[model samples]
Target chain A: MEFLRTLPNNLLIYIIIAHTLFGIGLYDMMFRKTLIGMLISLELMLQGVGINIMSFGTFLNPEPLTARVITLFLVGICAAEAALFLGIAVAVFRNYQTVAFDKLTELRG
Target chain B: MSFETMVVNIYVLSFGILLIQVITGGLIAVLSKSLVHCFIGLVIALIGVAGIYYYLGSPLVAAMQIMIYIGAVCVAIAFGLSLTRKAGEEGLKSPGPRAAIPPTVTLVMLLATLKGLSDRGWINVPHKINEAPVGHMLLREYLLPFEVISILLTIAVIGAVSVALIRGRT
Candidate 1:
């Protein structure tokens, strides 16, 4: 109970959470069969990286502005990435008629 | 308890709840068989991330997190999900013995690296809250990258539209 008061201020806790999220994302990416599920897992991984950046900015950096600017840039990039990938997914679905990972082995050698 | 202690306690409690929310959401997003449920979990996890940004003293980033992530990205993903056909007969396959090995190895390596770094006292530093300086620097020092990103986003939009249109016509 006494340690709870210090939890929010601890950088290590954020790191652990971010790492765990990344691990979960990795697990899902490898296990999920659908493209949409893989995309969701990718987003989870990105969010974990975002947390890591914010935590470092808040606890370790002298100038917080740089981190915030970087985060803003990251958000923009993520949006663009999502838009592009969703478009690609739609196109893939239109052509192939399925979003399953195993069914997408058209180029397998 | 002193005023400072009370404030710290409140922060801790809120953070604890948010952390749990984030972890649970991530788990659901990754583990759920239903695509819609996965999206919901992603939303919850992102909201928890926004709360974390708020705790980190960046209200602006927190707001942007909600706006961009929850509003734009997730919606785009939902639209994508809707465009897809129904789930295939072979639902998510359980990881085989070989498939399970890499992620576990990666996780163990990552945890070990993080622990070693922390033990080495490499991540310690003093920080302060300063949102005003962010806006200032954005227009000054980071102006070029900012403009480039705007251009990049414009290009991405055009690309996405063209791609969708081209596929539809074919």
Candidate 2:
């Protein structure tokens, strides 16, 4: 089909892929049982977003500042997230003798 | 209607396949009981994401995504995954991702929104004033934030190393 052929030729195809990856990664991050699994998925989600921003910049309107700045923000957020989560995970392992998400019941108080 | 179009069609086909691979990979990564399988699925998804990035016009960033995300981050996760035992014994089966609205309802809402977006036309900017390289365009305007980000990355690397070392003691 002409539409099918055109789809890949258009940069929108990449945008759709990026968006889908973002969604699935977020879903996994939210649903996964292990802290590491969630962190991996979160990393995937962030990479997807970076791809989206770059794609939009180069293809849609060509605004490097807009996309690159957003990417920098994403990098910062991911670094912070990783730091906080790992710190908490370590503390949890120390307190409960396990980092199992369910065993992390400190907030239940 | 020529050879180039045919090549483009093949590319599109491949992209479609990668899209499916990514979605399935992500679903499996989150849904699988085995931590190893989760790592495999996550790697697949990361590869697929990188493919999509290639199609987006920057092969460099796409390559970096594979190197930094798939290579480094996933390996780090693998280390963590190896530390944990079977999830089932621990009663740690995935939480199954709560949705404020059910997925089906969300799907329907999304379909309606897509229909509206396709029907309503949007305008593109008339002039193309700024089409500079990413570094030049953003670095000058966003210098402080950029420096802060580098600092953040340094801290995260040091922190992750320290955490892993501390855990190694036990």
Candidate 3:
């Protein structure tokens, strides 16, 4: 199938997949009760964005390396974000003794 | 079949498989009840993304994705889970029927948008693989952001350690 050959290399397919991932991540972020679950969803969303950028870099950019450079930066930022969030999650668990989003009402006043 | 056609077929097949893997892993990561299982799904999904990156012609990014996501982030999350055993023990609450509507609508809307854009003839563009430019650009033009990221990483490490330690002592 000619279509099949083009599908893998097509930018549109990547865009669709990236958007699907974003949708899934958003859904999880809204529904998941645990802080860790929320963090995981956040990572999923970041991955979607990363893929979208990479695809654009690969397919549309005149300067190829720019996208990869940005992607490298993205990876660094994501690692830092994950570390800080996990640390905060750990601190929250220590303080509240629970990581449930609904139970974290200490600052509700 | 000619050799080129066979090769193309194989490539398409692998791409299809990887795409399916990515979707399945993402669903599992988002929907799984257990935290550990969720981490596992994330790892799988990230691996799929790495594979996609490789196909997109950036093996370096693929390697980084595997190392940073699977090796560092997931492991760190696992450590956090272990530290907070009580949190991991409790099953996550499902968001309910209303939760399903938003994602479905979002997916449909996104698909429609993409289709419209493609119909307007703005989707496909030519690609070239230039591996050497990445290193040059990183060291030359992107040098400032690169150094800033290093500093940010250092600060993140210190801040995380301090936050984790302050509450841990009590």
> How does model 1 score by TM-score?
0.90
lDDT winner, 2 or 3? 3
Poorest 10 consecutive residues by lDDT, candidate 1 chain A: A2-11
Order the numbered candidates by TM-score, best leading: 3, 1, 2
Highest TM-score: give the candidate number: 3
A1-109 per-residue lDDT for model 2 (tens digits) = 7788666445445555666666767666656666766677787677667766766565545443465456546755665566656655554454456665766776796
**Model 2 residue pairs with clashes:** none
| Range of the 10 consecutive residues with the lowest summed lDDT in candidate 2 chain B | B122-131
* Candidate 1 local lDDT, B87-153, one digit each (tens): 4522357877856764676578667857666654524332346578787788999999999999989
Q: Which lDDT tens digits does candidate 3 get at residues B1-170?
A: 99998887898899999999999989898778887888788888899999999888888899999999999999998898778756344554656677777678767867786776664443434343667778888899999999999999999988988887765434
TM-score of each: 0.90, 0.76, 0.91
Lowest lDDT sum, 10 consecutive residues, model 3 chain B, at B119-128
For all candidates, state DockQ relative to the true structure: 0.63, 0.38, 0.63
DockQ of candidate 1 is 0.63
True contacts kept of each: 0.70, 0.29, 0.65
Clashing pairs in 3: none
B-chain TM-score, every candidate? 0.82, 0.72, 0.83
Error of 1 at B2 (Å): 7.1
lDDT at B118 for candidate 3?
66
lDDT of 3 by residue, A60-95 (tens): 676667889999999999999989988888888787
